[model samples]
Target: MARKPGALRNGAPFRDWVLPAAMEKVRKRLKTVDDGDRQMVTILGCVPGDGITAVEAACQEALD
Candidate 1:
């Protein structure tokens, strides 16, 4: 299968404290998710009109 351009290996950007923090956020969101609802997660890279760091942080927080 082909990989997404913005995708990083093993979520390297979110390291150390950031990783744990992100995981907690994702877990909390997951708890409230509706049953049978497909979760769509995307990690945005350094692109125009997007912050690579911020997007990574958000995705890490929501899906990483």
Candidate 2:
């Protein structure tokens, strides 16, 4: 079946802000939950992964 425009099919594009958007929440959370002075680091060798939607959903859940 043909996928929708934003469908997470093979080769579908994920946004540039996916990681940054997620990390922004993490930064705020860390400030409240952990040491406010500590910095968080994430390493992504690839730009877009197969599970981008799941990650986005998780970030949204964290913000809520």
Candidate 3:
């Protein structure tokens, strides 16, 4: 995703992957900005170390 961020929008692998609700909301919002795909991918990359739950919570908090 870092190398090919557009894949997150059209890639087969991502199409089947279900994101947490908050993350999904963030993704939708990100889609509206320039280089949003790359930004989203950067956020997604944090999951490995931060964990999805933490990321999701942070996304929700940010939304709030």
Give the winner by lDDT: 3
As a whole number from 0 to 100, the lDDT of residue 3 in candidate 1 is 49
lDDT of 3: 0.93
Q: Is candidate 2 or candidate 3 better by TM-score?
A: 3
Error of 1 at 32 (Å): 0.4
Please provide TM-scores, in order, for all candidate models, with all chains considered together.
0.27, 0.32, 0.93
Question: Tens digits of per-residue lDDT for model 1 on 1-64?
Answer: 0243222223455323333455346534654665211231332223235664575566575463
Instruction: List residue ranges in candidate 2 displaced over 4 A.
Output: 1-18, 35-50
- Candidate structures ordered by lDDT, highest first: 3, 2, 1
Clashing pairs in 2: none
- Which candidate gets the maximum TM-score versus the true structure? 3
Q: What is the alpha-carbon RMSD of candidate 3 to the true structure?
A: 0.8
Tens-digit lDDT track of model 3 for 1-64: 6898999999998897899999999999999999999989988999999999999999999899
Model 3 worst lDDT window (10 residues): 10-19
List ranges where model 1 is wrong by over 4 Å: 1-19, 36-58, 61-64
Clashing pairs in 3: none
